[model samples]
Each structure stands twice: as C-alpha cells, then as structure tokens.
Target: MSLDSATVRRIAALARIRVEDDELPRVQAEINGILGWIEQLQAVNTEGVEPMSGGSPVGQAQARLRPDAVTDGDRAEQVLANAPDRMGAWFGVPKVVE
Candidate 1:
C-alpha cells in the first residue's frame, strides 16, 4: 500500500498537522517505511501462539499479593494543612455550574 503525495497531504490535514509543501515527500516516505514494516510483520505465520496479557512469562507464577491494610487514618488536620481554601477537611474549589 504505497502512499502518494496527495494522500499524505490529506492525512496531515485529517490529523490537524501543518506539514509544509517541501516536507510532504519526507513525511510520505517515512509513513511508507512504517507501512512496509507492518507488511513484513503480517507476512510472518503464528498459527497457535497464545497471546500475552502481562509482562510475566506464560508458565510463571503471578506476583505475590500485598495484604490489604490501612497504614494511615485519622489525619484530617495534616491532610488539609496546605489548602488555600478548604471546607471541613476537604479542599474547596470555585463552582462552575449554573
């Protein structure tokens, strides 16, 4: 799928990018190179490969889960100490609704 200069200009306009007339050829060539790599990737065969869902290997055990415990509680004064405008333990903001 080769891209012409007109198609490249149209793509730039659609993406809200301002590409100069002289830069169109370079941009078009770069896009064509990316498309060529995608074409090469598509040509490879992977009939029964399982898709990876996370960084860990497929057969490895998952990471140990941390115990759910509250380490900090009842520190309202400390939490609200740096507020320019606060209302009863909460930061206050200007209302914008009508």
Candidate 2:
C-alpha cells in the first residue's frame, strides 16, 4: 500500500487538483507515510473490541424522545418564522449554481 509518484499524479487527476512536477515527490512521501501508519494500525489485534458510535459505548445510556402527542396549530406560521424572504406561503431562497 505504498504510494509512488505515478500514483500521486493519478490521485490528483482523479480529485481534479493541479500539482506541479516538483510537488509530486512531496505528495508521494506524505501519502506513503499515511499508508505506513494505516499498515501499523492493521497489525493490531482487535479480537474482542466492539464498535461504538459518537464516542459513546453501546447500551451505556438511552436517548430521550419527545412524547408522540399530536397537536396541529399554526403550521404555516411556524414554517415561515425565520425565512429571510417569503411570498405569502412560500420561502424564497436565492437561486444556486445557475
């Protein structure tokens, strides 16, 4: 899993990044260093280790949820409360990437 200059160039092309000829060696060494760290991590034994989410251990604490009591009131007013621009019932956001 070592990285070479050719592999670094290919990666830059695939990521749509422009790299100078002199920068290739530095990029290759950096990527190879990252790969070496990953290889070291892969050599560790995790036979009894379990996966956890968001820094919390499994089954350590329960998440709380609001009560499911249904009440419909001012649905339109609630939706338009913080809209920067609005036209009656609709929110007006600026056109994007046109």
TM-score for each predicted model, relative to the true structure: 0.60, 0.61
What do the candidate models score in CA lDDT, each in turn?
0.90, 0.88
Q: Which candidate's lDDT is highest?
A: 1
Give the alpha carbon lDDT tens digit for every residue of 1-98 in model 2: 88778889999999998989988888888889999999999999989998787788887786788898888755988889899999898999888988
For model 1, state the Cα shift of residue 72 in Å. 2.0
- Determine which window of 10 residues in candidate 2 has minimal summed lDDT: 56-65
RMSD of each: 6.2, 5.0
What TM-score does prediction 1 earn? Answer: 0.60
How far does residue 23 in candidate 1 sit from its true spot (Å)?
0.6
**Backbone clashes per model, in order?**
0, 0
